[model samples]
Structure formats: structure tokens, C-alpha cells
Target: MLYFEDLTPGRRFETASHTLTQDEIISFARQFDPQPFHTDPEAAKTSVFDGLAASGWHTSSLTMRLITASELKNVANGLIGMGIKDMRWPQPTRVGDTLRATIEVLAQKASGSKPGFGVVQLRWTTLNQHDEIAMQLETSIWVARRPTEQA
Candidate 1:
């Protein structure tokens, strides 16, 4: 598992891609979002998206899934998030769009109150097959510090 000491600023990790299918987008929207543009293809044709679009939340959820399934998830057995900041969805994710995610370490600092742990600042970027950014966010994660070894 990666400890706080191992995560340096500018370090980057990327995950395998997942294609967003119409069925998947519709199903997710039906359950959680239910916006016509996200749930009904015919209705979406006239929406600003001009086609069925995946909900921003669905895109975020898929990004989380990709990150957790990647090797980077080995950090401290799991990434313990402190909070998210500056989340933006710049473009609509459409059906059959293959999505990939990248995580970049922005900074790290020892926790003032939680000794043996640190808060790591990270930037997450999600892009579609055309390399268009679909979503981006900054977040802080609590990472365990390396344990002191016996002398």
C-alpha cells in the first residue's frame, strides 16, 4: 500500500477506460437523476445537449469506479477522502463515449490533528474518447503515513 510519503506532488495515475453505453446512461439516470435529456433519447434531441446525455453525477460515479479499480486504489487499502472542491463538468458525456480518468497529486501535508496521517491534495480529470474533458475536480484525501520501523 502507498503511504503518504510515497505520494509526491505532480505524481500522476491513469485508469483503464470504460465506454458509456446508452443503456447504462439511461439506467443510471432513471434511478438517480431522471432528467429527460439523460433518460429519454427522443426527448433529448431537442435538449441543449442535442442528444441523450449522461448525467454529470453518472460521469462522476463512473470516474470513481475507474479510479477504485485501478492500481492507485492500493493506497492505504482505500482512498479516504477529506472533501471535494472545484468540481466542474465542462462537456456533456454522450452515449458510446469511452471515458478515462487521471489523478494528479497536487500537494501533501501532515495532518495537524491526526498524527500518522496526511492530507493529500489531488486533481481528478475525466476525459472522453476525443480527449475532451468531461469533468474535473480537486479533492483532499487522508493518507496514512509510513509506520516507523523498529531500530
Candidate 2:
């Protein structure tokens, strides 16, 4: 179980790879973004992508799934996402692309109002098979601190 004390600034964690499929990309985009480049291959050929691509939101969701399945699920007190900042999708995610995520602790501070919790700022970077960054985001989360031992 990971506690707030376990996550120090500069610490990094990685998750297993996930391969993107055309069906899944189209399905996700159809349900959420429904953009031409994300939903239709022929249409995407005329767009800037030149091919069907996963929606930015879909990429973020995939990143979250990897983090939760491989990392966050091990947290002792769990985590509550506070907010996100500076989110960007630098490269398009296409079918057959295998993606992985790296999470780095940027900063952390014990909550003044909530002694039992701490606020942790993290930078999440998702990379494709070519190791090109597909997405990046800064997020803040509340993590429970380990109980202090009494003397």
C-alpha cells in the first residue's frame, strides 16, 4: 500500500502497455468526441491527421485505466483527483499503436487544513510505441498520509 510519504518529488512510475485498435478508437470517438478524424478513416484522410486517430479524451481515459490498473490500485488510502492542468495531446494515437504511461511526482505538500491528507501534483506522460509523447497532463490529487507513530 502506497501512502503519501511514499511519493516523493521526482519519483516516477510506469504502467504496462496498451495497444490501440481501430474498433475501439472508433467506438470511443463515436460515443464521446465523434470527430471526423477520430471516427472515420476516409474522412480523416482529408484532415490534418491523414488517418483515423483516437480522440484526446480517449487517450486520457486509456492513460487513466493503465494508471489505475497498475499503480493507483495499490495505494493504501486511495486517491482523489483534485484537478488537471496543462493537458496537451502532442501526437495523434492511431490504430495498432502500443501506448504506455509514465507518472512523475512534481510536488507534494501536507494539507494544512486536513492533517491526514496531502496534495500531490503529478505529471502524466503517455508515449506510443515509437516513444513519442502522445499526451501529457498535470494533475493534482489528495493522498492520505501515513499515521504518525506516537513516542
| Candidate 1 global CA lDDT score | 0.95
Clash totals in order: 0, 0
Q: Ten consecutive residues with minimal summed lDDT in candidate 1?
A: 70-79
Per-candidate TM-score against the hidden true structure: 0.97, 0.96
Clashing pairs in 1: none
lDDT of candidate 1 at residue 77, scale 0 to 100: 41
lDDT for model 2, on a 0 to 1 scale?
0.93
lDDT of 2 at 12: 94
Model 1, which residues run further than 4 Å from truth?
none
Q: Which candidate's TM-score is highest?
A: 1
